[model samples]
Target chain A: MKRVKFGTSAAVLAFLAASPALAASDVCKGSDINILMETVPDTDALQAVKGDFEKEYGAKVNIEAVNYSLMHEKLVPSLTASTSSYDVLIVDSYWVGEFKTAGWIKDLDALIARDKVDTSLYFPALMALNGTVQGKTYMLPFWQYAMGILYRKDIVDDPAFQAAYKEQFKRDWRMPATLEEFAEVVKWAGKYKDMYGIAMAAQRADPVVMEATNYLFAEGGDFYDRTTWKPTMDTPEAAKAVTVYADLINSAAQPGALGANFDDVANTLKQGKAIFAISYLFLFPTLEDPKDSTVVGKMGFAPVPGKDSFLGAWGWAVPSNAKNPDCSWEFLKWVESKDVAYKRALAGGQPTQMWIYNDPEFIKKWPAMSQVGTALEHSKGLPIMSRSTQLVETFAEVMGSVLANNVPPATALADSQDKFGRLVKGDPLLK
Target chain B: MTTATIRAGSPGRRRNLAQYVFVAPAVIVLALVVAAPLLYSIYLSFQEYIITYGMGDFAGFANYLAVLSDDFAHVSWVTLKLTLLCVVFEFVIAFGLALLLNQPHLPGRSFYLIVLMIPVLMTPVAVALMFRLMFNPSLGIVNWVIGLLGIPPQGWFGDPSLALGTVVFVDVWHETSLMLLMLYAGLKAMPGEPVEAARIDGASRLQILRYVTWPLMKPVIMVTLMIRMIAALKSYDLIYMLTQGGPGKATETISFYAYRLGFRFLDIGQAAAVSFILLIVVTLLTLVLLRTMREN
Candidate 1:
């Protein structure tokens, strides 16, 4: 079998060497398929799916799971060459517009229609975010995520703290209702020497961008005007949002909060040093795990406190150039199935499907599951645009500058707006 | 007559031809490995390239323009200042250490040499990470130590004001050994006659060092400075592992900015453009150093 497989791969390489532009349809048969994917937290579940896939299709699936950070660096050159380095790709939902605009991904509408794929099984919010590009479904949401405030239940439930908190805030102490109240809570929590008011991932990448968007959404700032293709984050509301975020990180959060990314925040929460953390719903199960978490039962989940509303969520989509589009769609549909999603939930994968959220048994296994599901219902997705990546990066920089006290919020926001506006205006697609 | 002439052909020609053929393989490999990628990068710099997970584009000269006008200009200036500061400081400290080590009667010189070499020999990433942990504002050793002395805890890498200086200190600790070893070798190789002649002329030890020793060590010092400057300019690992050009781009050097553009932003064209600019600047500096060496 090894000899046969080696011989077959050699043949495929020779064929590829001869014809660089060979289509997937020409070479995707007889046990030689390559799939590229970014490594996620659910590697074990994905491996199980891969095992099932190989058995059913009689094709070898080569999964090139990369650190999410390095995945794009590898993918860009391949896309430029139009080479079939990967037949299937798992991409972040934010990248959909950019990939589609660049003509790197294939449209899967025909394939989905041909397969009679049902979009109903997936979470309505996730599906809407993933597939819709000017009213067209381009990709599928495989898994969904939303940002929420994870807190220590023990700290919040303390009777003395509750009485003091109620007196200070002049309301029944629950999860914060507004950014001002949240700030006050953080300050109050920080007064205790042992406890950090909040832990945040402020490192200069996706974490900063994600957290910035939460603030942006709360303050009612949008990334683009949609019609004019002009960046809109330079408004007063946006400036206020940036100022608030900067203050939160510099004053109210943990000492080393600037260097902390998502994993660091999770570890900080799990270690019980932080009283509160604004993080994705996906981290709840892991944070609650008795084997990993020191504060397993102490962790509590709440919707992200907003000046207005929630901002970010994750979605899964199949790329257009997938070799096994049929199988990929089937897997996606199956994963989104109510029964399968519920099973996954029981197995500790956060459910993105609406029905699984309604499952009493799944919620019983993980107490925070219901809270995550409820948070998802009201979650807001990132504003879609051709230059969304640039916009996000600029926003992060502007927010960082404001937080570091290098630039005033108004000036930073205005600078970001001008920079992003130029990018959008320069790009024909954005126009 | 032709056969007789052929039999007398010179061995030098044959030997030289053989030498050329032997070196040909190395030259070809070098071209493939280094020259080819360099040329490709140059080509890419001229084109606008956006690299997503599996997608990107080509817009000529746009990337270069963008990088030149972008926030990276300030970052490049910061890097320039850091490189200059670090190279100068490392040279002075290293030269002083070398002078001390050169003393014939110095105690435990070998032990001191080995101890000094340890920092340079250590893995750069590990060293940077260790410093990062030690410099943490809240729970780090630096703060703990300071607190004992009744000094308030300093925000070592966390404060934008202190981050670059902290990084420079770490760089100096990790790299001064190279300078020390180079200068020491130069000092050891120095002719004893020059120092004796200076002593006979009633020169003080400091006078001898400034006039005779330093002048004689000029070539070695120049080479060390050039090498250290290049290394400092390209300093990425320590800075990357330490601050990642953060606390609001206070510590961002050219290399870090280029990396962020290429890898993080997936803007390969912009990264390539920045790299080409860096290459040009370094090459010009190198040429200037070589010219000065030739003139001297």
Candidate 2:
């Protein structure tokens, strides 16, 4: 019934909410709720609207932003010690099972029932895979994402390079339409001595594995068999994917690609030093920012040239030890409302609702953003299990062995299969 | 094995309740700060305490056994190597610098000493970040310097072969100043009579340093080694920031390995076992140092 579009007239924002809902709840009206969020565009948008939220809800919302790598280190201790420090947490999809199984997160069904919230607003895949464990909702998918290819339009549109590429390949050079074509662009662009054709977050950590999963998906394999929860990394297709991914780093990628992560890869794109990058769809805003980016307005976005890619999500949940859960729920319900989702989208944070993509005004500025919806239909998140994060460690180890030690992909995959199999099977909770 | 002497005018053959009262707070603080965590870790080591999965089964020595196998062995071996390399290199360079700075003719000597200790004065996290930027293969000054010296481009933290050595180099750079300060103080505090006697007997400078200076500085050397080794064993912030134990776990010492297991993997039981193992090893090493240290 109401809307909060970014470019709308200022009078609309003032009149959007007929009555403030949070003011009715005494506990939420004056209480302070602390939110632990990853340092990302979402946090930035949240900060931008802090005064608005405080004024509307009549509560103090303290946001403690931290690097994504350190969230587990901070979150675990508080949950384990039962310290009611953080009322809300921005958690990765991979952590859903762990948090739910450990009883660290409060089941959200209670709040959903009380508020009569429409749970169908999120992408069903994200909701099912990220927010629900054993049919109980723990978190709401806040900023859902899938991997895409980000490349330099100005560089590829150069007359000389395009002419040369057309002459060499017998086709007009354009945005890559397939994985092979993408590789060709990388190799061709890499030939210039001063520039690297592609940048990859091949660092032997979560980033590398995240990128490599795209390869595995494109190759028609996965990290594990879905129904059995058994590792399939040693399968021929997955092994081939691992080899190609590693070889791409060894050859066409930037010199220090083996040690780079998503931030480095994004900066590589921003600096105009690389022609291509593969990461979350949310990377577009940073690349478009004129303040920090050199390649603003000179980039193109596409669904990853492969048939599939990672469909990751970061969700918001109330920790079981949350001191102000009523306040947290009051905030969560307000934020997930359709108007707020649209508002978040306009303010540079990603909105999880499927309908936001079809907004005519929003589409005028970001027509390419809708392609991600199609990509999400094909992509899959990491294996759903309490020990899924452990698999990230194994992937890093296996990929590192290939990149750093020259271990054959098949051998490395076999090793990982054994390790990950033990991890999934050996855990009593997983059983 | 040691004789006790009563102070002149002290009350004889009576327990000093006031002395216990004076020490009680310190004892309480030590128990809370050090002993409590140690006891908790021991208790956790025997359980399957995966924090995310809630209460655990009584795992007995299974968690401890897990720590003894697989990656733990590699982690322990790396810790030992790093401890030896860091302690040895820091001591040699620090002792050399101490002797050099102790020379009476050196101009601006105090200024140089203060400048040298800057690394130690800064926090390890800041130092690690600075070094991480420096170690960047393409853009970092470290590789730039190498290229200028007619050497080819090199990966510092990014190379599996060179990564451990690179962290070791950073440790020595940040810590050698502390060692230098300790040995310099020791050199100044040494008995002047023994050096004078050695000088009068026509001993060479090298001979005096070998026979007289080193033997007399054993107590200080023992202290330096104890503090440095313990710190090196517990080193985390530096490696965590710089490489996150990468180019494939090259610099993943025992402490980082345990942290990864506990925090990252959520396997607190095995992590506790690793911590207890490190505790035992450090205790034995400290006892060895004490045994040799008391001989003087």
Candidate 3:
């Protein structure tokens, strides 16, 4: 084993030495530009774009594919070192404030203006998510997803279940209209012997934060008051919202839901163990694909039932220290363009362009894409804040505590409020 | 006559120089790798360092103050409790196993030693993950087996009250093997003269174990306890995989807390501060243990 490891290391060194010379002569001009991208499931679609990008620009794009969690860790150290290891980065939407406030991302508003890029083609909600403090675009949408309810059509379509759902909610049983109605349906569906009524991404980290925030926002609770910079999540409505969610999970969600994340929830739905699930539009193609799912044609999508507001889509952004800002901006525009974006949608990549939802080819490829469009139409981005990361983290802890029944919702939110206030006042940059 | 005396000393000096040359590489490697990083971390512990993707800042002593005042005090207390509990449990179990294995004419002693060492040899992450699956409330083998015994399924890691204990159980499973191995070796090497003397003196089996065997094994036990305590205090991977310090921070340890502060929150300054504090506590405990061992 040691001998093999040594031989492999030597081979790698040799390859590394030879590749630079070969790359300089063939694909790139001047210096090789490294693009650090968050790993997405659709690698094939990205490779196609990479081929075209290299051919058009005469610049080599070194794609450093990293897991989302590690990407964040790597970003911080690289940024601190001021090492141009990554010319472009795909960051989470919530990270925009941290990156922008730190001046770690390049302002792309001027670049967008220079390119005469048409913003009308892009989803407005997705576009809004990329804007920084001064309404400057730091990133553009590469792919877009909105939170929606995924349900088993076979169960929801059953004659008796449909009649009961419609009678209870005063609707066609197609989609839930309010948070209360959603909880009722979940409880109603959970009574079945073979399936869980609902499954959510409750696993620790960002997934839990995302789901928890959706409910918090839906209940008209803000992480912090915009004017006073005080957290308002400890309100009665917020507690009510949290309790509603907790009750649903406690009574209707699958057992062992505490450790389940996006992948686990998706698997549960795909395996037909879950009657319904809350997830992003990205799950649509996979869940609808006959090859990948047992319930391919049996799954359906709906907008997340909202009490007062809906959550928006997640998009992409570029860092401020990009070496090849021009090329990266061009790539962003091309990717978000109607034609290219629609092509990507057809190939099972979610499109951030508004026109793709209307495109016949895209709709035919995956019918559930329309539900994403509907969700996006009504969605609202998270309340903008300088201390968004702290808010999200504290909120997750609060919500998780409530769900675990370790603390009442009101107390959890109160603790979060105190912590958020401390963080804001403590950090001079944020203030 | 003086020149001949100088020539006679030259070979001895050359031999000393050869010894230094042979040891130089190892010293150089240690300085370059271990010592450098340790010193760098100490330096960073004093600064409020932010490693943003493109920019960073340093604030002196702020990181330390934050960690000292942060919510991590509770987490630190919890970690200390967990470390003590796990270590105590491991020692008792391992020492008992060692005593049993030390008996003459014990059946398949070698086979038992191999079987017992397997848990210690397994990777902590793999073991944690396996236990996680086994403890799954819905489909886990543990729950299934319990059902057969007419017992209700318990939320092992899911329940906030049980999460820490569950992780502790997993840690005990993985770590007892190390203690067993160490104690076994210690037991095997124990002098038999003390036992023979105790027997001649008409000491009961328990009395001999307590008065003679234990007294002689004191140094070994102390050293093993110190080593195991240090290892337990630094426990991160197993807990991380098992609960991720979740169910409302019920299972959050100091090391996991530091990681969350550093990586998850991107509050490197606070993380550095917590780590330094942890270092101070560990160092003090280690010194006390060492002094006790010396006295023994």
Candidate 4:
């Protein structure tokens, strides 16, 4: 099968390259397809290999990439239309439930069964959170952004600081294994002049909520009780998480932390001004790039304290009214194939396939791949519901108030609980 | 009244009908592009149209009430504050510069005009992004520049207390140039006779400005203020780029609130209602401004 796929692809490529007029006996020959994707490293990797697909399928490919924040608003109008301009969409994990419920995306269960696609190859978190809604698969996992701590190894591993940390905390200085240890490290590292302990993306609305999720997960608190559909934010665990998260931002994080987003946080670490950053594994490539990062080769990755972090991911799905559904699925299958997934990972994408993390070549190149594999295994995603976006907004608002207004964590959590309770009161997915 | 006279009247009526035919496309296009979406939004405002779940039941005034009781009050206040601050500051500064630039013998007058209008030429998002970088508390040039003056670095947009003012400052920077252009044009268009007459009558510059120039510029001022106010009220790109209505909603405005509702929360009905409310507010304000203009 592999030989046939490669043989066919190579012949098609040669035919197209040799003569533009020569047409292949492929359904996609001369066909045009457009894809809407978020502007991430994975998207860039996919775009880099777009010519391969175009050549192999003898089709014209158009990719429109927008920032993750703008992707939803941009996709909604196209998706909700009677016909979509895009054949495929890179659906964010948070958007899966909404898109599925609205029937904006096609269910891929029958397609998967027909093709005998091994869905187990994808990270379980990605499959559960982004690829499927309930028992129905709506998308093929494209990329995963398992959240973790990307820290400056040189700074954290400094003998002087380590000794000082050991003396101060009565423990050997190492990667934090718990939330309390993380706080201790942050505070200790923050005391140095000209260097912030952590680069936090605590900007209101989305950034703060995304950053706060690590704390929430560490404390074993979620936005709500998933099983019972009740807000768990008012619990003591949630209050502690919120308090710790806020303290980290207000006390130990870089200047303007309240206004920082993922870009700012990454830049902070790249500039060598921060000792640590709570970031996604996907960002490791950019950090490792010598041209973009001043601290290249000096960074290390780890799962966030308590072994739980927010899992960010996106999957590729054909729109329900796609002009070329078959072509879109073919593109997905080709991209998710082991070789292509490996190529993408090598091209700085965070591939969704778990096996790629275990690849010797990938592990050698990205020393943190093993850690990333572990992080993905333990990560949690935002609750999937049609109304999860609203829940996030409410969470962002509460977290924003707490960070910016100095609202007490308990009060903020209580307020969020009420809001979440109201939001999820009739949400059918919870049951 | 003979047949010829009747025929002439018939031709005149036909000419009028022909004029309507000529304008029909534009009217239809406008109805489709502008009026259609607006009317649909108004309709959506009356329905429980969550974007995710698709259109729901007839919601009547529920969306409006929900918005009004929720973030509407805060965002409206924010919007009003932002509009007033931006328009007032922009007008004052722009008028001041306009008066200066209107001078017949001002040095580098053309250079100043070109440089002043640069902000207007730049996109609002670009301006916001530029200002956001400049205002970065740690790495930005603004903090460094201020530190040279023996001042400590300050969180400009990151601080809730400073975010709104920071946004207003950026808005003024971006919007003042247009105001300056308008007022300057109005100043140049003014007949110099009144000011000369006031001067010959031994009136001071301030006195002449207060009496003659002020009265003559009133209509232009009113029109400029109305336009700027409307634009300021509808401002979203700047707020979105700079703050995302952040630092705990300090910079959140009506338009941003509407966007958050519709796009972020998928509450299209409430968003539409909020938009209608903004439209109403703008309409009423425009009416008041027009009345004031007419009174002048």
Q: Which should have the higher DockQ, number 3 or number 4?
A: 4
lDDT of 4 by residue, A138-216 (tens): 8888888788888888877789878888888898877888887788788878786357888988887777878888888
lDDT of 1 by residue, B75-108 (tens): 8788888998899889999999999999889999
DockQ of 3: 0.35
Tell me how far the alpha carbon of residue B26 in candidate 4 is from the true structure, in angstroms, after superposition.
3.3
Q: What C-alpha lDDT, on a 0 to 100 scale, does residue B282 get in candidate 1?
A: 89
The global C-alpha lDDT for each of the candidates, from Candidate 1 onward, is 0.73, 0.79, 0.73, 0.84
| Top candidate by DockQ | 4
Per-residue CA lDDT of candidate 3, range A142-258, in tens? 666578788888888898888876776677765677777778878877774356888776766667777766676666676667667776877887887888878877888776667
DockQ of 2: 0.51
* lDDT (Cα, tens digit) per residue for candidate 2, span B1-296: 12343543357523475678889999999999999998988999999987766557999999988778668878778888988999999999999998888776899998998998898899998888888788776568987898899986666777788888999999999999999999999988998888789999999989988999888898998888887888888888887887788776777888888888888888889989988988888888788778766875
Better of 1 and 4 by lDDT: 4
User: Clash number for every model?
Assistant: 5, 1, 5, 0
Quick one: best TM-score, which candidate?
4
The two-chain DockQ for each candidate, comma-separated, is 0.36, 0.51, 0.35, 0.73
**Can you tell me which runs of candidate 3 are displaced by over 4 Å?**
A1-67, A109-119, A131-133, A164-174, A192-194, A289-292, A307-340, A423-431, B1-69, B100-115, B137-139, B147-155, B196-208
**Regions of model 1 farther than 4 Å from truth:** A1-40, A44-68, A81-88, A114-117, A132-138, A192-194, A307-344, A426-431, B1-66, B99-123, B136-155, B192-208, B264-269
What's the true lDDT of residue A277 in model 3? 79
TM-score, per-candidate, Cα-based: 0.83, 0.90, 0.83, 0.93
lDDT of 2 by residue, A163-224 (tens): 88888789987777767677777887778535777888877578888898888887778877
